[model samples]
Target: MRRTFLTSMALSMGLAAGVAQAQEKSLTLCWAAWDPANALTELSRDFTARTGIAMNFEFVPWTSFADRFLNELNSRGKLCDLMIGDSQWLGLAAENGHYVKLNDFFEKEGIDINDFLPATVYNYSTWPKGSPNYWALPAMGDALAWVYRKDWFARPELREAFRKEYGRELAPPRTWDELMEVAKFFTGREIDGKVRYGVAIYTERGSEGITMGVTSALYPWGFRYQDPEQPYRMEGFVNSPEAVEALEAYKALYECCTPPGHSDAYMVANLDAYKSGQVAMQMNWFAFFPGILKDEQVGEVSGFFVNPRQNEEASVLGGQGISVVSYSDKKDLALQYIKWFAQPEVQQKWWALGGYSAHRAVLEAPDFPESAPFAGDFLEAMSNVRDFWQEPEYAELLQAMQRRIHDYVVADKGTAKEALDKLIQDWTEIFEDAGKL
Candidate 1:
């Protein structure tokens, strides 16, 4: 009888221990497979060391990142306890309750949203445009920027020829027209007896690549979605003549300067072109700048600049915010991770590890802009950052854009005017279906 009782007690204690261990299990974070994700892995080691909660990551390629994660979220898969979602995903995620509203959690934990950059929070965290509803914590702060081969641009012979012909010094361009001229000069030019192309921009057809890349040209040339006082009234706003001109300029840049077989190019393809010495210049997200600055061949020769202006300086925002999956059973544990990440020290380490920290304290550090080659450009670009649609129907809208823009830019099927007109029609259909128009 005594032995039986002891055995039963021991079994109960063992089961309890098992449950406790399971409760303290590792967290899985999903994000795009890129330079920042690598930095995240390194930065997370300290979190694990302090909390004893192992960190697991799901790094999906950017091309398919949205499809994979959105499916996971919609299915309420427990695979990702935390996710670094794109800014445009906030509205859909929040509206559908896929992400936990962070307002109460942030306030309870004393995590001040003011500490993060206003642009980051507005674009990445908030829903309903300027509402106080917070669905995510800004993790990565990014914007479009230009990178060029400084060594080639600085060559006196090229500079002299450029000045003589184009009547301008061969240097980083300050305007899109000047950039086009520079790109023209470098296209198919022999550098070190090897022919290289001029520029590489995102032209990938099946995803958000083309839209994101083209917006660098779009916003500066006067593209606006709708009246600020009204939403879903996009007919004239989207297909305006200025917007048409911008898209034409974008397609022209694609045809004139990019390498052959560049139709499916995005982040990886652009990085490869620069790293392999295949292109003289590239336009990419600022988040990739840290990795570029570390590349052996490209780092020493490269110069960084904000995307050149057309009629004004503007850049497309490209970072993501970390959100807790609403269906996650481990919400408490996820909140713990958020609290840890919000600390100023951790944010500082994030930037040091090549992740762009959105925390104002870290970004505003007196030496922050000078900390890296593209740092100043990043600061300047973020100040003028603009975002695409931030509605619950964003995915539908983005897909429509991908189809229309790709048909024109990559497949060469139609003119910019026709493309934007079709885009306006498509967006109107989506808004109508959503009962917005």
Candidate 2:
């Protein structure tokens, strides 16, 4: 009897150990979790509950996201099992072959990717569209638009004053030109015995913040990076007549309205300014909008609208996507995640957690416009959003463009024409090297 009891106890212990091993192999996910990233994780709770996997999440602020992600990737599969990288990293990651191409898996799993917003998923998740493979899954919803002090806009005193100056009723400016008119009207205006600023234009050269802010203006001015084939190349369109025209307009607005040292600004910089009532408006991401509303300090006065257009409203289609590391040993598990996360139910959970949906159906859900704190504004404003270049060399092209434009507008270095011609020349050369020109 004693021997039989001991044998049964040992067998039970062995079975339990096997079950635990199968359940938790350990998963580490790395991402940028500012508001959007946070929202994605909240959406991921269901996956954790259902799979019984021991998941580890790695989140870094956007401030050092690139460096952090790059370092982790370079660590040779020790850093993470899953990664949701920035759109700009797509090319470099793909070129380096450090990411598991999901095309085969996606097809084998029968994921109808056609349901995703093509412009967004293609640009942010693929290195070169139509290539044999895709690199990641859409991780966040992104669009560029202006966030303003709606409470102030709705104020009777400000409204009357704006109408008197612009010869129109006080309302969201219909165009970029009108946005300037609005900025100038309230900039430096006396309010409750306090001084105020007109607008916040990101000017900081730190990281990619300034670059993103600059491109929000540059692209609509008809700036093209290179011939379509040579996407990585840059040219002198930086000083083009059109390019300069865009900068000149931007410069005029900056001069009269932006806070001091606005040139060194980034996403958070502008948010800080708006939160403090230092700047009346800023061009920023959809992801940040939720945070502005959540933070007690700024929620009282913040407002949002689609990025205003100069000739038309066109903002960079920017955001991040979820991907599996090429060297990840547990790729099947990661693919399971990608497939499950795309479900409408999962998307709705994400929405409830303050995330924007990547799918049109969820974005257009009848209750969405009314349920969340600011869904009405976001859904109404999605029409004006657009995608930036998602090619592998996307950052190189953007940096090249930023350098030229920053010099011209902030430093007053050269005629827009001179800068643009040189930029165009530079970009054309890059195309030639790529055999695209």
Candidate 3:
């Protein structure tokens, strides 16, 4: 009887220990459902193999990504141990305690922020813009970039026609004016017996699409969110002459160059249009470039370039940083994952696996530019990239820009000046309500 009791007790204890171990070894990472998420999943297998930590992923489509994950973070849910969140969410996540500050962990692990691209560090990791207060590690680096049909540009007949008309070589555009001319040249032309359009740009109104697209044009044309000297004072800056001209230029491009009924297009719609050979050029994030290069339809014929210069060179920043969820019980494991991920070898492997490594070791390698067709353009774009407001009230700021810009650019409801003036009014109200004005 004694032996039987001892055996039963041992069995129960063994099962409990096993369950505890299993729980400690598992982790969940959340991000938007996209190519990079898949790459991260593939790359994480090595992490699992090395540390014996199991990783699970929950990926939401981009349309609902911010809503779903922001809600998860706001509600203090433990569904995710790690989150690869958007750059614009850093301030909100840090302020709201959704992300665990990784500064001390980084220092303890000798993970230097200087080793990552400066733009990624600034946009993705830092909460106070240039401060050293880091709530995340820059995981993927991306920017708005242009891709065109190389074969179309190389056609001798088209080149001759473009040169005759525009008095310039038929190459990728070097400036905004040149870009518009090229876009116009291709807007209604017949290519390979099919009618093709000039460009597929962001026009989607519901989310951040139009804001991103409009800002690409706005940035090069010298748009500023507010007076840098007097913070949040957006009166002259947001509705300045340069900014109004940029807005007008974007609206004109949309009306004259885009495909029929492209008023509601964003990333996926642009990708589909490009793949279907409906557009000669497309503006999209560098995160999609890897898949674009491997695409069966237009891969071989595609070429990429940085956003053209206007008054200055600039591109809209895109990408996210990986953070440990502050509410997670598995913080130790999540931190371990960060340490492992920050290694030079791991970063190199990440790049090889189609994940954009912000690590300088990977980006500055001798052969890095030659590693991918778009790598050089990606580097250039990152160097001159700018991001949207990263304030805790970023959603309100973005929504206002979206409404104002979409109404002007897509719906043709007002003049550029009127649209921007209304935007400043909207943003001013938001800031005043937040006590920041």
Cα lDDT listed for each candidate: 0.91, 0.73, 0.93
lDDT of 2 by residue, 1-437 (tens): 99999999999999999888966666778987577776766667788888766677899887778778887776675667899887778877888887888888888878766666665566656667645468887767677777787777898988888877777887777676787888888788987687788888767654576566666676666666544655444444345566667767787887789887777777777888888878778878778877887779768677777666676556766677788997788877877888888777887777677777777667766776777555765664555455545555555555665676677778888866765666666556655665655
Per-residue accuracy of model 3 over 162-240 as CA lDDT, tens digit each: 9899888999998889889999999989998999999999999888899999999999999999899999988889999
Best by TM-score: 3
lDDT for each residue of candidate 1 in 258-376, tens digit (9 for 90 to 100): 99999988998999998899898999998888888888878888899998888898999999999999888888888889999999999999999999999999989999988888888
What's the candidate order when arranged by decreasing TM-score?
A: 3, 1, 2
The TM-scores, one per candidate, come to: 0.95, 0.87, 0.96
- Each prediction's total of clashing residue pairs, residues at least 3 apart in sequence or on different chains, is 0, 27, 0
Which regions of candidate 2 are displaced past 4 Å? 1-24, 130-132, 227-240, 372-384, 425-437
* Least accurate 10 contiguous residues by lDDT in model 1: 227-236
RMSD, one per candidate, in order: 2.7, 3.6, 2.2
